[model samples]
Target: MWYVIQTQTGGEEELVGLIGKIISKEYYEECFCMNRECVRKTEKGQEIFLRPLFPAYIFVVTDHPKRLFLQLKRVPRLTRLLSDQEDSFFSVSEEEQIFLENVQNEEHIVQRSLVEVDDEGMIVKAYGPVGRYRNAIVRQRLRKRYVCIEQDFWGKKRKIYLGIRLREDGKG
Candidate 1:
């Protein structure tokens, strides 16, 4: 099962490292922050970058949540585990976990999607993770080269923006 840990925004990487050192390997299978690939226009040319998909939150795969929680106390800058009450950690729902597992790659990065749009600025075809969840798209920001998708994350509705490279159909 995957458990969520909240920490300071922009401190996810450092917190993950801290947790790894404090927690025993037997208690957790993996600890990582999900990332998304984005294309940025730099002075040199187009550049790709990775950003946290869920800022301030990292995911840990563990069967023993109680033990992991206890060990996490020693980790500094960690906010708290996603829980309903004291000492009771909540794992992501099966549906949410499946969606996350499907969209992210082995490195836990959601790669930028390639999309083809018609003259009317409508997405005609999409490839990659975007293609897999086309119906979930709530807004298309073609000018910004991304789309906002509404997804149920951690039992709440979240609008996630994913990078997309758009090419006009019938043109090279």
Candidate 2:
């Protein structure tokens, strides 16, 4: 199961750094923080940066949430595990889970997609996670180099932007 853990908004990296030191060995290797590569505009030029895909949340894929939580509960900066009941946890909706899996490449890094749009401004083809949901794309930002995909997650329409080729020229 994939579990979401709540942590201080800007402190996810710090908390994740302590995982292996505090959590049980069985769960430590399975915990991860989700992030994505996106383009950012700077004074000099555009640069690529890695930012959290989901803010304030870190995902851990382990069957032992409670067992894992017991050891992690006291860690500083951690808020709580997303759960509805005591000692029990529920996973993100199936679709969201699948999205996470699809974004990751062979090395387990979430790859930044490179996409090309026609002169008419329609997405022609993409290579990476963004490609998988071309049909769901609702917005495109050539300046920012990301595409917004709106889809159903837990019965609600959640719109998220994934990083991609951020310009009309599709060049860095």
Q: In terms of lDDT, which candidate is strongest?
A: 1
RMSD of 1: 2.2
lDDT digits (tens) for residues 102-153 of candidate 2: 8775444566677877887677988788889888889988666788888765
Alpha-carbon lDDT of model 2: 0.74
Counting only residues 3 or more apart in sequence or on different chains, how many pairs clash (N, Cα, C under 3 Å) in candidate 1? 0
Q: Please provide, for model 1 over 1-172, each residue's C-alpha lDDT reduced to its tens digit, 9 standing for 90 to 100.
A: 9999998899998888887887789999999999998877789967889889999999999999988888787776656888999967889889989989988999999988889888898988998888889999999988777898999887689988888987642222
In order, the Cα lDDT scores of the candidates are 0.87, 0.74
TM-score of each: 0.94, 0.85
- lDDT agreement of model 1 with the native: 0.87
What TM value does model 1 have? 0.94
Candidate 1 positional error at 135, Å: 0.5
